[model samples]
Target chain A: MPENMTHVPYYPGCTLKSKALGYERSAMDCARSLGFEMHEIEKWNCCGASFPLTKDNLMGLTAPTNILIETEQHCKERDIDAKLITLCSFCYNTLKRTDFAFREEPGKLKTLNEFLNREYKGNVTVIHYLEYLRDVIGFDNLSKMVKTDLSHLRVAPYYGCLLLKPQKELGLDDPEEPVILHDFLDALGCQVIDFPGQVDCCGAYLIMRNPDKVLELSHNILEEASEYGAQTIVTACPLCQSNLDQSEAVRGEMPILYFTQLLAVALGLETEQHQFESHCIDPKSLISSCKKFKEFSDAK
Target chain B: MQINTENNQAAIRDLEIATGETISDCYQCGKCTAGCPASMDPSPSLLIHLLKLGLFTKAVNSASIWDCMACLTCSERCPKNVSPAAIIEGLKRIHLNNMEPEINLNSLGQEFLAHSTQQAVVSGFRKFV
Candidate 1:
């Protein structure tokens, strides 16, 4: 638990802190296991995700700007150099695109700077934890460091739209179907399946005005998942997990689990610390079959 | 400006608005929810979860909307024919409208520019779809 060992800034967006608590925990453990430390950016606000309801680009730009300023101030105060590691897919996409906007168009960055009245120094690199996991920490190293390998389970790697959508910023894989999740799952020794609904949305934000609609989309993904022979769906995004797991409560029975939940089990982590059952989706039947691997108790 | 919940919800009825039929078929079974991956979120369980909490606003303006693969997995499994994927698409459109054309390394926008690939013959999927 060294606080100064090649520390990076970990930005656990709203979902990570609340709904996706499992993701945050696994991410922290994963980072530490890799011998790295993450200092959270102080008092961060929402990234004006999706959109600000104004239908304007500038408003959208402003959301990330708020975050950028906050991150900059933190960096300045600490006098430490580290790129920002984002846990949420949406957050990663937002920060990466914002940073790219600044770098690609310095003039726009300057205009933005005038609004802030501070010098726009290239302070931090906003990167997705997956990228950090793969690039900053090598795949071979990750494979070697795995205290738990989910070699027995069959998983469908759901990319969801945000992560793989804007292909360029995501740059993780193919536009129609990506392989990053599949690769990560494979690294964990889970038998990854190529499914049809691989790139679909989890009906996340839509849970508000349209429960019926969420049902339709979610049902579609699950039906296809069954067709694909996926016993469980694994996602890196907490929102994705929320839509995939919780959506079933209103609907019926679909087996959806977070990637971290399985990873935690594989890592021999205690169920109480990870709390796999707290998820709206029941992982019982899915992990019940996992008995062949190791002893799993639902203490949480 | 009037919040006509019934009419608005009815308008987007039966998953597909163009159908214009009230999908009176729904029995309120959790079948659709059970089959969905996006339903992994809490709000997806109860349509009310979206409204009661402030989650609805975030959903429409969410990167999560764009995250939908539109595999129709939920639609296919729904006993009531909910088509949560379509609603997600509708919300995603809202996000897309407000979306800044992130010309960064992750944008898939450029993929639509050409109708042709290496040995190719095709327009952007948006046009054909």
Candidate 2:
């Protein structure tokens, strides 16, 4: 490892360790290829999964606050910038919003710190991997690092809801019209398809209580992407990927991929890192076809 | 509509203090309802209207609050910056605080629990349970 390699704290939340292992694997590989290292934070807990909606419900804020304090400590130990990166959009939203809450109200921060018996100076910056790629690595530079020609693949970039919403808090992109995912696919040389349901919610936690509603909602996103001629749909949220991938309505019609998996493929990383078996819709056939097409063109 | 001025004032005060959002700021522009992806009956605007009219019980007990995905599109699109999503969430908090949680975790099928993502289960518990 280069001495100057940028080392940033990473929080994988719960899904990444279990259901979304591919997301973490591919993201780590991509970060390395892009000249950065994502060191997982020590003993990090879940970011409470959801931000507390009511002002009085400080209990929900505890888990994320503890994680933020841990990230700050990790940054100090590594002597790196006080920045924490997350691959899951849900974690990104919760952590960022929690940090925002603390910044907005010092009293809440003080209360949380006191409760946790830890100190967070409101110094750590929470960022999603997509934002790190765009702002830090620059898509132009990422374009230069692509090892495979993925232009044959027509891809739809799914933003989902948590990644960009409550604009005043997340502020990652225009919640109405986001371009980060589109720009990311462009950098990878894939033909990006702009679809209607790109930024819509995939029924999220409602999946547990109402799978039918999730299917209907996810089906709409898949149908729209397919209508626009997309071969695959890539998303940043594990829950979004799972909801869309497992929907009985569009089960095998669209291959739902984590954005980092596509990035790993384009970077020419090992195929095993993608962990395609976890995906409900097998993306292997689609990826292999693209690979064959690239070989033919290269041989010519 | 029986105008219960006393009940209305208390409900409005409780909501405002809990959510830090002014329900009266909503002007029924319908932008929030237009962008909502979930099947919010009485719609986002009408829910706020119910609250504004001091029909707190009607707003809280409506099945629409449970149907909300909390996508925040309604909150983002609100022209008055009322954050209807937060208000709806406040209603959910109130509902949960007052009543026994409608969705029991043990009652959920084992297959569903096994297949679902952790975030879904965690957030489901946070919101519904």
TM-score per candidate = 0.65, 0.95
Q: What is the interface RMSD of candidate 2, in Å?
A: 0.9
What's the DockQ of model 1?
A: 0.03
Error of 1 at B78 (Å): 31
CAPRI level of candidate 1: incorrect
Q: Evaluate residue B79 in candidate 2 and report its C-alpha lDDT on the 0 to 100 scale.
A: 80
lDDT for position A91 in model 2: 92
Report the number of backbone clashes for model 2. 0
lDDT of 1 by residue, A158-254 (tens): 8776665445444765756576677777777778888888777656554433446666777777778878777788877666676666556665566
The ten-residue window of minimal lDDT in model 1 chain A covers A50-59
Regions of model 2 farther than 4 Å from truth: A1-4, A248-251, A292-300, B1-6
For residues A187-243, could you state the per-residue lDDT of candidate 2 as single tens digits?
999999999889989999988778889999988888888889998999999999999
lDDT of 2 by residue, B10-106 (tens): 9878889999898888888899999889968989999999888878878877887888888888888878888887888888877677655758778
Candidate 2 DockQ, CA atoms: 0.79
Q: Candidates' DockQ values?
A: 0.03, 0.79
